[model samples]
Target: MIRTEFPEALYLLILIPFFFIIHYIYIKKKKARLNNLVDKELIKTIAPEISYGKLWTKFTLLNLAYAFIVIAISNPQIGTAIEKSERNGTDLMVCLDISNSMLAEDIKPNRISRAKQSLNNLINQLNNDRIGIIIFAGSAYVQLPITNDYSAAKTFIDVIDPSMISNQGTAIGEALEIANESFGEKNKNKSKSIILISDGEDNEEEAVSIAKK
Candidate 1:
């Protein structure tokens, strides 16, 4: 895409007008000094061709050229359709806590809500990583399967709420087990990681054992 990596750099537009104002001030000061040094008639005789209107026109054109150069330095690029060869990466599964405690208003809107915001930030940083989602309370289910479809993962994450599950208790082990199962049939050699988002208030001992495996 023809995306500008440093879009904030365009704020340099603010400097353009500042430069013009300074140039105008300098020109005015110089003209005043010249007027003091000579008679009005003599000054006009010396520089009759230097019309204020023509000077302004030249300045305007120079500013335009300066703008073009700035844009060029900012690397004005034409996006080309690039057919890139596919590259494989790691499988990352995210396990989120959907328990009642997660709904506690300990953090801003709540723990669960804040966790979701953090997850959204994380997803934006990803490139080619295949990802999965699993949410569990008293039971576990495949909130999303391992896939390269990042949009689908985000959609599934957005829909996760307390009402989605019938149970209210946190079953950390169940969530881990579901995540482990989701990796079946995938390339065994690929790097795999699981990110668990929870308040760590309630967790079963089995969760540690599952994590070790």
Candidate 2:
């Protein structure tokens, strides 16, 4: 992606045409003064090296060079590969609670709806980090495999509801396990995190143990 650091400098381009017009006027006045001082044919014979076409061509080239200089001053930049930079960001897996209890309007509209909105906002703030989603109720499943496809993550998040899972309780431990599995073995060595967004309701006592693993 090409970006200009000083986009306002592009307004200087308008000066190019103004410069040409002024030069044209100056050239016309010079010609008029020269015609008054000497015959046109005589002037041409006296200054055979001064071709009007060549002068105009030189001015055009100079103006183009000036335009290029102005553009350079604007500091146009191109996107560069970040392969050499150290990989510092974490791979995030969001484990969202989509149980029927999330449908309660206690948190304005519902917990599940608010969670989805917050997740979407979180996705918007990410840069280059891989993200995935896990929806859980009585059981858990990977709604999206871990990847850098943030758009797909949001898409999966938008469609999440209690109906997606037939099981009818909040199994935080099973959800944590499913989220762990979804991360895959390839990213195990890398910085990773599972964000469990629930209403502090855990029916399964094994959640703490699963999280420790």
Name the candidate that leads on TM-score: 2
Clashes of each: 0, 0
Computed on alpha carbons, the lDDT of every model, listed in order, comes to: 0.82, 0.87
lDDT tens digits, residue span 1-213, model 2: 788999999999999999999999989998889889999899879988867888899999999999999999999999964567765677898898888889999898899999999999998998778898888888888888888888888888888988999978887898898887777778467888899998758867789988987
List ranges where model 2 is wrong by over 4 Å: 1-86
lDDT of 1 by residue, 13-51 (tens): 678899889889978987898889988799789978767
Give model 1's clash tally. 0
